[model samples]
Target: MLMENLLRSKEYWSLIEHGVVTAPANATAEQRQAANESKLCDLKVKNYLFQSIDRAILDTILTRDTSKDIWDALRRKYQGSTKVKRAQLQALRREFEVLEMGESESVNEYFARTLAIANRMTSHGEIVQQITVVEKILRSMTERFNYVVCSIEESNDVTLMSIDELQSSLLLHEQRMKGKQSHSEEQALKVSNG
Candidate 1:
């Protein structure tokens, strides 16, 4: 959002590189005025960006004079090194690969779990392809979903199916199974009470 604002206002140049006051000593009055205006604009943008940060983080960067320094500091602290990113991605991949639906877990819960790991992987610069996610869901769901999973695998191309489609199918099956169980319980209760 900050980047969007900067881009919209054409003020991104201040953040993209180290901004320097470009006023020359021999410049005319108009040139000096324009230079001062540019400097003021840069300072305003820098201050705005700084103000958006939390107080605790603000303390860490209060001594940093330039906007570029503050931006780099924040980015480095959050983004980390390449090695750190690789390790984070690897951990997310392991979590995703080993993910399984608990026996009593609902389709929504399972999908949420899977998507969380996938999103983390994406944040760490890994591509969580839909096909990969679909295959993982197809293979990792509880046994209750086997029939529907088989039907899907047989009738639809799992490679081409979106995660939403698979999730909807599984959720429908889950709801139907739950309904049948409730109906069977009611019948059993009626027989016993009768």
Candidate 2:
């Protein structure tokens, strides 16, 4: 039992060689800093990432067909991972595909359409390149959000930094963004009962 507990423990670093999870090639330091600067909740950031892609795809598809039934059918085809972050990205991808397919574009045409859209915008192409990129960005957003949220929920997750301590870091971030010393602002902390 003791051995099993040690094996399953998060802190139990061992010789079991896990594959290195790499960040995206295009994920520059500047982009990462900016992403860190605009710290929103995980769910919010995921949707923000998807909004433009979904709109462009939807427009392309609508040019071909306009059936709700067909749109719904197509959404399920490309939906992302069902667990946590990927699942959310997949949901947005499905929404975009549904909108795009609404215009009756063939699968080939769909890829072509996306290529055209990507060419017009720098970011649209990059986000779709690898699943790892999505995970990396989402992981950062989730970590910061959860840390702050956990600080707010002190009864549980006591391992996380305390609320007052996290607020100091948060204040520094806000001050840096504003180019001024921290001032009084009522920032609500997220508390989850779950």
TM-score of each: 0.77, 0.18
lDDT of 1: 0.84
Residue range 47-154, candidate 2, lDDT tens digits: 332353467565554442212222333444443334544545555565444333223333334334444443333222225443332222223232324553344445
| Model 2 per-residue lDDT at 163 | 32
* Candidate lDDT values, in order: 0.84, 0.37
Backbone clashes, each candidate: 0, 8
RMSD score of candidate 2 (Å): 26.0
**lDDT string, candidate 1, 1-194, tens digits:** 45536634775565447564667889988989877876776677677776688998899998876667777788899879998888888888899999999998999999999998998888778888999999999999888888988999999988789999999999889999999999999999999999
Model 1 misses residue 141 by how many Å?
Answer: 0.3
* lDDT score, candidate 2: 0.37
- In angstroms, the error of model 1 at 155 is 1.1
Off by over 4 Å in 2: 1-56, 63-67, 70-74, 80-194
